[model samples]
Target: MGENKNIILALVLSGIILFGYQYFIAGPRIEAQRQYEALQAEQAAIEGTENAGVIEQDDAPSLPLAVSVDPQTDQSSSGNYTYADAKTIAINNAELSGSISLGGARFDNLFLANHNVELNGEEKVQLLVPANEDNGYFVRFGWTAVDASISADDLPKATTIWTSSDTELTPQSPVLLRWTNAAGIEFLIKIELDEQFMFTVTQTVNNTSGNPIQVRPYGFIDRKQEPVTDGLFVLHEGPIGVFDDNLEEQTYEDLRDADGGKFESTTSVGGWMGITDKYWMTVLIPDQAKQLAVSNLSYKASGGYRASYLEKAASVPAGGSFETQTQLYAGAKIVETIDNYQDEFGIKLFDRSIDWGWLYFLTKPFFAGIHFLFGLTGNFGVAILLFTVVVKLVLFPLANKSYVSMSHMKDAQPKMKALQERYKDDRQKLQQEMMAFYKKEKINPLAGCLPILIQMPIFFALYKVLYVTIEMRHQPFFGWIQDLSVADPVTPLNLFGLIPFDPPAVIAIGIWPILMGVTMWLQQKLNPQTNMDPTQQKIMAFLPIIFTFIMARFSAGLVIYWTWNNLLSITQQWYIMRKESARRAAKAANKA
Candidate 1:
């Protein structure tokens, strides 16, 4: 009896640990995020009306070691200019639409045309914003002085307006901008784009100043303020890059602490660095053959985070010219597109931009299989269902053996109970007798847990895939499930949205979660209950309800998969239980 009780206790504890995290940790975080988003929206509306036409200055916060800074001043500088004063040049492409500011020749305003700001919304998703705004996030390129021959004034400043040869930038038609310094030195930038999100920028310097000048060319992505994050530890949502063949990921908090200081990797040969959001990325890709230093820093005065790189300085002789070509990737992180760039451009580990977690070996293949299924069906929800069926089929032999062993244990329950009662006072002897009886009946009690143990890692891997992949974001399933990446939108307390009243998160159970609970309850019925204590049986019976509450805020795709898996398990267990009962009855009749 004690031995059997220990097994029951172990199972109960496992279930509790799995569901406990949702209640004690994830539940409050979701509620806080909801409130924080609402507050941000309200603040943005107020700021738009109050701060209109005001020129917001850039933040030049202090840091420990600066990657690239103005040589004229020790402190960072923000230009005194308004959005109205700056001229904008449009970039219209099939996949991207935005404008470039002529003032700094910065690729600061960008939007993903295909991705919407919200599910089923008309407005497109914005990737880059104006430099004057509070949350000014953009990319900038310029030269850092390497020798005394070049002064800060000789380099193009953020306020320097360049003359563009073309009115607009397109995939086929590129734009060229040129500026000249006091000493007759000319700097020209030619920007080119592809059909997709890749941007090829070639910077050329013409030194006609009669004196050779030494300078280093560099580019950086800066965000004025920290953006909202989902706060899940498994997914990184800040600075990400591959330096010298090593992948480095730093969260927003980590960058904030590095303010007025420098956090950088040693000089590496062949890597790319950039800032990453949940679904989008803005990174600078240096030439793989060139040696460069990748660094991230936080500015204390401006409260901005930056990721930048500096290539080796070159000395341009008088009347000599130097030019180099680099690439910039700013768009949705679609796995296929990134992989294509990695193969064609020779960008080292570019696809590692996606957070593949520790189980990339397994998670990557799982995502690929599901993506293939989604391509055929055109519905992520349906693909998840089909994927569950395929997984169950693959594990059928192992599940079958587990269920058969469980059935044999159920058949020996009467003898086991008799032994328990006979040696009730001696706990050791009772355990010994139980083991002997299990061996005599050729039943391995531990075999029943094998399938469950195998499935746990698979479940976690699938969760990471759904959580980190952009392809799953804003995807629709059947009715009432528009975004499979988020929790089910329809809540039972609100009568599935007909009431128009938002319920608390604790009562936000959805229809799919209820169905999952029903299937779990049915599966439990098929399992042996004869040896369980009354209290343990009651606890086991309540597990389905507890899980239903725990999974209320999970992604709808995961809920659908769980419900389908439970139904399959119930069907298999029922068939095995019935078969064993009939065999026992037939043997009894033959003995009579």
Candidate 2:
């Protein structure tokens, strides 16, 4: 009874923590995010009327080419501009479709050809938007001068127009953009694309001038507005990078609160920096052998943020040329694709982009197992079910031992109750007698908690896999489950959508959660509950109900896993309990 009370207390505390976090912390944060987004929208409307497509350039970093201090006179700030306003080289590949802006040679327009904005929508998922758009997000590369003789005006700026060598960029053919300054230095950028998301950029400086010039190459991803994230604590959606083989993640708020709204890294031999959304990312990978510096910067004045990298200075002598190569990854974060990129390009910790939570050791392998099953089954939902069975099989021995212990405890329940009645007025005597009784009967009072404890990490890891992996996005289960990555859409609150009225998310309990609750309750019935007081028993009975409501908002795939696992546990425990009962009855018959 003492051990049972302790376990019950722990369970209650866990529930309180989960519920309190959801209700007091997550709920308020979501509401605040909504209000912040509304305020941003209102501000955007006012700014749109006043400035239109014009983006106010801040005091550009010293390592990058400086922008015009006065926005009114900045050439890049000139009137409303669109994709049609610039000369662009069309980019067409099997997995992507967009154009590279020739002006400033920017990767400003890109879309994932294989991914759609919605499950049933024809519109492709836009990854990068032109700088002229309201939420301008783009990647651009250029050279910054290290010598005093090479003025900022002489270097290529965002408004500088480049001549493209090719009309279109494809996997088979690369494009070269060329521009020349008045100093007679020719600047060139050769851009190559693979079938997937990677873009290889080679920037060259042909110093035709009689003087030797020193310059450093740099790349930047500028986002004009802070993106609205999912706001979940488990996932990250902001500036992320790997510098010196160390992973770094910073939120938009963190960047905004930093000193001067900036975070700079020491020189690293090889690294990649980028801004990551929940499912998409745009990363700049510098040469692995070269020394470089990375920075995450936030501009409060213009409401913009940037992730940038600057390579070490290279001296371009007269009649000689200097060149540097970098790579850009801009697309969806498919797990396999990211891993392949890391292996092929030697990108450090690229798989960390997926935000596989603290249980990465478990989460990663769990994903791999489920993904392999998905490959064979052709459906993520079926794969999850099979994976749950695999987990059960692997844990069968330990679970069997746990169930046997629980059965023995249940068989000794009558003796335990007699002891309780014998020592009703003596608490210390009851404790001593109960301990002796447990040892004599070979019963482990805490054995019932072992299975639940082991399942916790697995549950969290699977949840991470479902929430963060892009492969799960838009993947369907059986009928009515079009996307397993989201919560079950049908709810009994509105008669499974038969009624026109839609219930609030809080009360919208789905079918899978209810089924899970049923299975959990059944599983609990098979466990040893005789030692618990009436109040403890009542609290335990309500656990399934509390969990059902809590998991109602979880992804459908996770709920399915829980339900199937509970069913498996119930079957195993039932078999053990029945076997134990038969053995006890057979012994009694022999004694009679």
Candidate 3:
């Protein structure tokens, strides 16, 4: 009875964890997403009405470019703007394709060449879009005048149309954009692209106006609106940065309500700041040797947010030129690519761009192990299976001790029943006797809970890996399992689509979840269950069903891992039980 209570407590705790996540986190997110979509549609309709006519280049609102000593107070232009069909320098490479808008010299239109919006679709994933589009996001670099003599208009503004040196920008060929102001200050942005997603933007200012000038180079990633996030508390999606080698993450809501709608970091020497989505990110990496201040800001008037950085002002002597380089990383958050960029460019904690959660210690290495297996198998699903086997082997010793203790408890059930019957009238006596019985049998009543407790962190770490990593996006397993990063699509509710009717998400139970429930039930049966209260027994019997429903909304890859882990556990426990029973029978025979 005591052992049964311990098992029941463990099961209840597990249920609470899953239920709390769904109710407190996932449920609200789903509703918020629905509301956000409706709001977006309404905004689109209003924009469509206001922007009915063909908008000229001159009519487009210029993005405000101002540098403040306190980045929190930096302001930007407001009002609606259209994507002007202006001149652009074509950008083509093996990993990315887009056009660099010569106007404002912004990286406004970019797409990941290897990733698609849909599993079977030809349309590529757009990482950055034109400033006028819905959820418009882009990166731009400019010089901020620090001297009172240099006015903002005398520097390059977003309206400035720079002349491009090259017709096309590629990995092999870099482009140089040149612009001059009335003050005889010529601003040049030499853009270079790597084979992957890193773009090197070197800003050079040649001051021909004789008088000494002071200016600070700055870069910013602008998002026209708050994006719809995954809504999972486990995954962060919004403004993130690594300042002073420490990672900081803030949500859109937090940034909006911050003091003056801004969050600033202490002056740090070389860090990266960016806005990140679930799979993609746009980070501004300044020169590693420069002292800079990073900030996350939200503009209520423009209904947009920005992550920006301002470097220490550089003094350009009367005839001397000032040059500073900042790198922009815009693409899918592949772990290897990000790590490589971190190592190659000496970007501080660049891999932190992918929200690895608080369990970075475990989550990253777990991903690395599965990633290694993926390299050999060419299939992420197979890699997950192999990784599970490795995890099981590594934890076998501890689990074996737990299972052996459980087997002993099961073997002593008959004696335990007699003890329970004798003390049924006295609750205190029953408790005292049970403890004595457990001691005599060398059994730990709470031994069964150890395995369940141990699995919780591992489950969370794997879930984080599947939920946040781009490598798992659109990855296929076997038949009908095309995308492992989402819930199983083939549901039995509509006879597996044989009836041509799609069931709602509430009843959308898949085959894998059912298999997991079955394995969980079988594993539970192998545990000691005799002399337990009838209500507790019933509760134990229903846990598998409860978990099946809870996990139905989780990613299929996670469901697969859970199911595979359960099956392995069941096999190990059953073997241990059989061995324990055989040993008990042989000892009795020898005693006879």
| Per-model C-alpha RMSD | 3.7, 3.7, 3.9
Q: List the residue pairs that clash in candidate 2.
A: none
Q: Candidate 2, after superposition: displacement of residue 135 in Å? A: 1.3
Ranking by lDDT: 2, 3, 1
For 350-438, candidate 2 gives per-residue lDDT tens digits of 89988997999999999999999999999999999999999999998888888788677767778888998999999999999988988
Better of 2 and 3 by lDDT: 2
How far residue 431's Cα lies from its native spot in candidate 2, in Å, is 5.0
Candidate 3 positional error at 129, Å: 1.4
- Which candidate has the top score in lDDT? 2
Worst 10 residues of 2 by lDDT: 65-74
Worst 10 residues of 3 by lDDT: 54-63
Q: Model 2 compared with the native: what TM-score?
A: 0.91
Local distance difference test, each candidate: 0.79, 0.82, 0.80
After the best TM-score superposition of candidate 2, give how far the Cα of residue 429 lies from its true spot, in angstroms. 6.6
Cα lDDT over the full model 2:
0.82
- Predicted candidate 1 versus true structure: per-residue lDDT over 1-592, tens digit per residue: 3444565567667656655656666556766767887787788887676555444433212212454344332112444555677677789899899999887778889999999988978999999988867667888776666658887668777676778768889987999988998899999989999999999989889999999998777777788777777666668888888876889888777765664444576477768888898899998888888887444444445567777777667789999998887899999999999999999989998988999888888889999999999999999989988888888889888888887787787778778778979999999998898888888899988777777677877877888888889999999998988999988878779878889798877678899889988888888777776556688778777878877886777788888888999888787777766777888899889999
